[model samples]
Target: MKRFQILFFTAFLFLCANLLFAQINAPSPIPDRVVLNLTENPATSVAITWRTDVSVSEGFCELQPAAEGPLKKEDSKTFKAKTTTIKYEYGDEPVIDANQHSFIFTDLIPGKKYIYRVGASDFWSEWFEYQTPSVENDKFSFIYFGDPQNDLKSQWSRVIRSAYRHAPDCGFMLYCGDLINRAGRDVEWHEWFHAGSFIYGMVPQVMTPGNHDYNDLMLDPHWNAQFTQPTNGPKGLEGTCFVIDYKNLRIISIDSAVDSELENENGYPMQAQKVWLDSVLQANTKKWVIVTTHLPFYSPKENRDNKHLRKHFQPILEKYKVDLVLSGHDHSYGRGRVSDNPQAGHKVMYVVSVSGPKMYEAGDKDWMEHSGADKQLYQLISIDGNELSYQSYTASGELFDEFILNK
Candidate 1:
């Protein structure tokens, strides 16, 4: 009996020792902050990005045609990911290094469903499915949000989640700017990632930078590391200011933050974007044009006006007959046209909205068709042929404003 008891005690200690060892040295293969971005050609390619701890130096993605049933791993094709080390610092926290991995899958069949997962042997992410935009689906809808700047983890989470729930079939999501409060704060960025969770990984994001997303008008280094956007913009503003053609629609992103810097010393950024905007508008062939930026050309708050933005961008919008100009920075909801008379031939509709907890009082303006104050809202836009439908909903899923623009 004594010998049997001794064996039992010995086995219990051995089990505990192994448990501790496993806890200390388990391989971390899981990826965090997984996101999808529209490549230059959405019909044939998709861009995916994710972050892992330093343990993961290199990773690959396996993709296959998605079906209704479980994913068939045997039929998967592997694509190697490009990895970059991101060294970030925030206040007093020790500077740390993380591996940012990106993979752009090309030659994909348009409008087809594909399942993909990332990682290395024995440590891989669960299969995620995404559908590419197809020319066959000529008519589609997309969700747009102005700014998710403050309290992203607590306040902004439900707004985006609600928008996704409301329009699950939308092709992609467009964020105007001010994704987070601080430019280079990793904690804030971590909250931004956690707020959207896996929704970002599924829906492609086309985001522009707000003043909060930059440090002294220069973009955050971490921005380029995590997001892989089209490099088709002007010479300097590659990721922040670019254009993407999704099906029959052309979406243009501008960095309006540069206009504010124009007053200081760096006026070249705005001038550079101006020249690029003219050339881009001149070459547009899509049926619809939507431009997005951080600053509102027409401010919505009392004693607040972006004079530089208005002087520089409004003319191009008018010249191109742009359908919509979505903007943020006022932290209020306001929509109006270039002219009070909607029947005017060269009018462009402008909208400034907010999707975070922050709120500002709506100021009166003659050009506004609809305005709301202290409301956190998200917009659902549907375009079918020449008719474009726009709807704004409050955070709790209440419709606050609706309009349709017929071309």
Candidate 2:
């Protein structure tokens, strides 16, 4: 009996020791997915979003000078920024849910490279570096794409890889909308990050919300959880709408979902959005203005005439002498020069493009200077002085269209 008791105690102690060892050997939650988004306020700021396996109550990132040459003591100095933890819940009974964290880094030096890394508690992620463009870098360039909506792993990766290879020098990226078919799908978001794995961690991306970007009526949980942009928009328009100023360019992003007529009478957010847009455009001190959204004002796919939007916003765009309008959702490519009032005066070119596997027949219109029906493509815009050069390239790096916008 004594020996048996001693054996039982030894077994219990061994089991406890094994449990403690297992806990110690367990892996820490590393930052699996990371994304950098550009804010409209200025080129001196950027928004970073990342995900972890467990809930993070608090998070922060350390930024260091990404300067070349040998590292010195002074070069090792670090700057830290705190992140805001955003909570998100889904389903009726609240049984299924998750939390996402984001942070905005501001007051950064433009045209300077900075290295950064995120961490939560004792878990630290790997270091990544990015450069902020100078407000005066008129020679800057960017990549514009639309709708990476379906087959994210296989098809979308090809598009993203092709764009990265062709436009490696692009300072930033713009997604017109429909990044994922369903906004609330965690798996889809994961695939999106994976598809753009090559450039996502390095390049800053500016995204507009699409119809599919929002979840079932009344909720845009995924969008709110993933992105953080300028909130200087109209009342109640918050994340769904915002603006960012890069160099001499002003990029305005609006949520057409709220602006669309699908909402109830009292939920018409477009009126307020337009009122705010008028003020923004009227108050603009920038040299050039570009507006971006998910729905196209001139689509070759679905309803060609976005009647409500055209009726309410087109006049405002023309009235403000807006230079360009970039949009997605048509699943095709269309660019046309618009002269206010059809009288041929001040002109603004509206462009609709798609970057996913989907395709739609290009409409034939006199105003349409160029249109494509079959290839998956991305656009690269280079702005130098008063000249804006636009080039649309296929996934295989073939130049499908080219145009120049003179100021």
Candidate 3:
């Protein structure tokens, strides 16, 4: 009896020791902050990114075609994820550290649904499905949000969820900028990811960095680490200023580092973007063209005019007859084309909106056709051939304003 008891105790201790070893080796290897970002060609490629604890040195993504019935793991192909360790220090906070992983799936069939998940080794995320944009010139839509900077989990989450409810089939989401209140604070980025939850994993993102996304107009290191963007911009600016030709429209993202107080050897980053924009617009073969950036070319509030932005970019946009100029930073909602005849909307439509809980009264409203304040709003823009339809909705899913432009 004594020998049998000794054996039982030894076995139990061995089992516990193995469990502890496993725990230490794989400490919270679960993937989090998973997001999908757009590549240059949405029809044939997509980029995905995620995060995990430092224990997960390596990561992977499993891809499978979507079909009816249960997913068969045997039918899926595994692709390794590139992982990088990110360490951040807040103003007076402890250092935040984690592993970020990213992968770009290329040569995909257009207009097809694909299932994927990301993780390392035995830990993985649940299967998420995303549809590719069709190259057949079919109608494509995307959701646009202004600034999701404050009260992310408590307030901004509802705005993103409401956008999902409205446009479940959106090809991708466009964030004008100011995604958080701080530049390099990991907690704010965590809240931004938590607010979107699984929605970000499915629909890809196209982002422009706002002032708050930078410290002293210097970009946060997290941007380059967490995102893999198009390298089509001119020298000195690659991911921040890029052009993606998605279906019938040519989408261009420009950086606002030159809007006010930023300087480099290249003279304020905007010069290169202007040259790139001119070339891209001159050679644009798509039926429509839209530009999205952080600061508005036309400010919607008093004493907030972006004179430099207007002086440098306005002529180029007018010369090419760009369809829309979407931007944030005013914290109020304003949409109108600056034309002599408001009825004859021959020029580009400029829109400025906000999605966070922050409120700012519009001191300038005479130039706004559809204006509102203290309302968190989202816009769904659809393009089918020559007609583009835009609908704006409040956080509670009420339609706030809308407009349609024909090319």
Candidate 4:
């Protein structure tokens, strides 16, 4: 055990040293931490967000047909990005003052490929190509990752890379919260963005906030500044909780950390979200509904129950017969249905998974149809007209578990 600790610390130091060297030797003026996301309507709208040093204050995105020649820059439409000044501080590091830029290109031709890039003046990122979903409902697949909370650069990078390899054309990827071990830590966020690399620029990200994503009982400003999500959530929870429609599926993200952890301030109770979520689920017109929260209603870890969260949200989920609920927080993996008996009526399939190096012993409960301890896993979910298919895979690309649901 002593030798293992020594080796682990040595490797950690080595990784940090390399990161510092890269930052000191090579700094790009264009932009870093570029990521894509879906707008309220992904078929006709797409959003991109990125960060730049304070110098590059003004930014814009250029879009053109993917087939157009590279020299046709004059024919592309340039949209000015909304820039916000973001200041982040963590630990002993000096405060970071950076500019975050966001742009949502709307009224786009559906089912067509387009190349886009973001920057200002003479500095710009490489062209990134993306395709909009069909205007009408179409079959699509997406990847879901749970709690990439530890060893992001050193260990968690493989999980996301393998997932991309498994589903290169997935419409988008969803992070079920706990993206990092520390909240508002610039170094940790850098590790996360570095681990994902260009994958974030290719596939849009749908994310929720986990308990670990907060510092001092409040969300890190970096989250709201970096992720451009739908703003149709309840008060005090703008981007953290909202709903988006993609093809035939409706995804509702909930901020379970603040309320369940008793961090609610200024009357932002779970009840408020209960009312909003009930309405959201009630008004959902999509054939399929998938709700994602960081804390699981049915806990798979002993002594770590979120009864308050379940009390407020599970009824709505079961009432609406939500197709699936994806979540992570216990640092373990479990997939299960609501009932142990086969005769149970309508139920929602709940999944808790992990994607980082952290692991915890599983608490074998009767609800778990499949349970795994000390494993890093990702899930690929695909939806057709009347059916939804789910497959779980390990870091090595092994099929860990799978199931199918019919509407």
By lDDT, the best candidate is: 4
Estimate candidate 1's alpha-carbon lDDT, on a 0 to 1 scale: 0.85
Which of the predicted structures, 3 or 4, would earn the higher lDDT when compared with the native?
4
Per model, state how many residue pairs clash. Answer: 0, 4, 0, 0
Query: Each model's C-alpha lDDT?
Result: 0.85, 0.74, 0.85, 0.86
The runs of at least 3 residues in candidate 4 whose Cα sits more than 4 Å from the true structure, single-residue gaps closed, are 1-28, 68-71, 260-267, 339-344
lDDT of 3 at 315: 78
Best by TM-score: 4
Residue 326 accuracy (lDDT) in model 4? 94
- Which residues of candidate 2, in runs, are more than 4 Å off? 1-28, 67-98, 259-267
After TM-score superposition, what is the CA distance of residue 7 in candidate 4 from its true location, in Å? Answer: 32
Model 3 vs. true fold: TM = 0.89
Clashing pairs in 1: none
TM-score to native of every candidate shown: 0.90, 0.85, 0.89, 0.91
**Which ten-residue region of model 3 has the weakest summed lDDT?**
257-266
Tell me the TM-score of model 1: 0.90
Q: How displaced is residue 367 in candidate 1, in Å?
A: 2.0
TM-score of structure candidate 4: 0.91
